[model samples]
Target: MTGAVESPFWTFVKQSVKSLFIVAFALSATSYTDDVVGSFEGLETGLSAALNTSTATTPKTTYEALDQSLGKGLDLIKICTENADAAGFNIGTAIGWLIAAAVIAFGTTLVTVIGGAVLIVSKFALAVMFAVGPLFIMLLLFPITARLFDSWFSQVLNFTLTIVILAVVMAMATTAYDAFIASVDLNSNSGESPMWAAVEIGALTGVLVWIILQISHMATGLAGGMSMAAMGIRHLMSPVTGGLSAARTAGNIINPVSTRRDLESGMMASGTRFDHMIAGNTVINPAYRQHVMQNIGKNWGWQKGGSVKN
Candidate 1:
């Protein structure tokens, strides 16, 4: 026997134990399901607080503010029209009221639709993130799978962040609406100049509409950028598909008697160059041309006019 310090059997036992320990250490390093779930929950709470949903600073949302403003503005106009009719002719006031009403109607519908769409998209993204939470936990057992899901997790996080940004924008719009209402009130209390009040109303309306449209544009751009990134990642990973196809071909070759005829016919039909035709010895024999064909398929495909595209 060789004068080795450790016998082969003992050395083998020590290596096995070391490997088992390493695997255990790796498993312990991965985050548990509860930890991941808790992290997601924390993110949700933080975002909600930041978005001013039932928060201390602002009790009303942009949508609610718009609704209330519409009602109050109509009431004030009705009262003014009554007073004007009692004093004298009110035709000018009626026409001004008609124009204001039309503007308010248009603004209300646009804001409502845009706000609802944003909410729907944000909620849907959150739902998908929750649904995939379990899959993410399962992937921790496999490092490759975990890496694959990492990009998706990041995209979901970006979407949630985008929603928060949108909320802040809407909050700004709400503030503008409040300012417009205050300005109108000031005009009413003062001399009540119709020309100045009309100008303020038009300017305020334009500001609010522009803000909502800006929000829509920013959200759309963010989503488009995310989609393009995902497509780029897909393109980068596409080369592995050829390797998988080659693996399947190798599987078929292992039991050629069962799969040989089909494989051969498929290659021939695809306009591949299969030189020799034989049933007994030729089919049973592993020809150099067959190996060449296998390698060719791995890197190239047959095209029209007997050409190859790589």
Candidate 2:
């Protein structure tokens, strides 16, 4: 009688343990599936944010917007003798070649102009920033010069990325610059009429545009040349049959491809972040912002930056 009672008790204990393990395993699998899905979505969104997309009739969402439109608007009627991609890549390569070859002169000008900020610190980080930042800015922003003519120049030149970046920059800076100029006039205004002030400001704006145009053209042309040289070399090396395979393989390794639909997911994520901030649900960490501000101040300069500009 005692042995039979003990046997039944042991059997029930074993069944309970087995049931617990099955429940735990099921929960773990569900959690893992959810994690994998979230990771895939994160990567997809990041890519689209880097590129750009919009549904508005006017597509100028960044500083690149103005230049891109400027270039596209002008090229609306031009007929290319070649396929669009070929034309763009060739032009970009040619520009790059010319600029790379002539890197010393203009490159020096850019460095000296930009390095003025870091020269004050006269330290290692400052020195590196002073030297490398100018080169990057020149290589990157120089392509916007093509916008003086038409979007086709940038498209054919394949300078769209740079133009887009430039647009972002202008968007960030425009309001502050306009405010500063307004304040300056308010403080330093002569008894001169308001109309006269408007005329003078307008003239200044025109001059600035002209100066930017000159810079943009040279930069874009040089970038285009470089793009062409790269393509030309690739073409010369590969046989007609073997060439495309080699080329495509190289691109796959170099550029890495992605799809458009995934991009929208990221944009929506960023847009939501802004919404969160506006809603006051998300807080801006002051310490982190201050750190960023310090970096930018170093990059642009702090109080004495006025003298560095010209």
Candidate 3:
């Protein structure tokens, strides 16, 4: 006899349980989204404060701080030029001082302009990512699409860290310029040309460009490493979607009716016989082997028919 039908009461209870689970999931997602948005805002604000360059301004943004630092650098260059001119040297010495000032100004301007452009672009990219981040977070509900979220998050973190690193470098450069300006002795006639000081400042600016480049490379490497680690953890947590099942699915799609031996034979027929050698087997195609032997004999001045020396 057929089993008794499931009770209506039990069916209602099951539906209620499912509804409860859906509500709970929705609440959790909402809470998580709020937390993530709050964290992003907080991080932005914190970066702004940490990198602020203005002593007189409260609540300055990172962009403003970097701009202020760049302005200070330009002013420092102007001061150097003015000091050089005011030294009252002869025409020859004045020309030399002008040349030194020009060099320093060019180097500093180049570094600051390029660094500022990069920072601006990074900040814009981060803002765009943040705006679209909730969509990626929602993608976390599906294991198949979780990698998209992981990639987006990794890019966001990379951009944020890059901005921080560049800001710190700019701030350091500003401090160094301040120190250099303070230590300048325009009146000292100790037989040392002030052009040397200008040269040193120019060299420092050149080093700043290198430092910024290294920081970008470091940020990219760290982001790649973190993304790889996150992918590994995700794969471990999702064995059905990420491991042997995925490999089997891929294999089936690529070669639905071909067995492993069939694939190997096809590869061998396609001139991939070297794969056997790479696998530590002595198998080699006769034509390929003969060609290599002929080349070796010819290069070593041996007869092609035998190994005898020519």
User: Which candidate comes out best when scored by TM-score?
Assistant: 3
Model 2 Cα lDDT, one tens digit per residue, 101-220 = 233223223322322222222233323432332233223223444233233222323233233333333332233234434543322123322333334434433443444334345445
Clash counts for all predictions: 0, 35, 0
lDDT of 3 by residue, 1-310 (tens): 2556556543444445544533443346575456765676676567755665655532244465456556756775665567567667577667666776677778777876778788888878988887777677666555588677778878887787787777677767767766776776544354546678678877888898889778777777777777455453244345433554577667657644321111223232221334444433232545445544555545566456745576
lDDT of 1 by residue, 48-164 (tens): 566675645452543454455455445545544544444345567555544554455455456546655665676687778756655554453454565545555565665565565
lDDT for 224 in candidate 3 is 72
Which ranges in model 2 have alpha carbons more than 4 Å from their true place? 1-60, 63-155, 158-162, 165-182, 185-192, 232-310
**Global Cα lDDT for candidate 3:** 0.63
lDDT of 2 at 223: 51
CA deviation > 4 Å runs, candidate 3: 1-34, 44-61, 83-89, 187-192, 227-310
Better lDDT candidate (1, 2) = 1
lDDT on C-alpha atoms for all candidate structures: 0.52, 0.35, 0.63
Better of 1 and 3 by lDDT: 3
Ranking by TM-score: 3, 1, 2
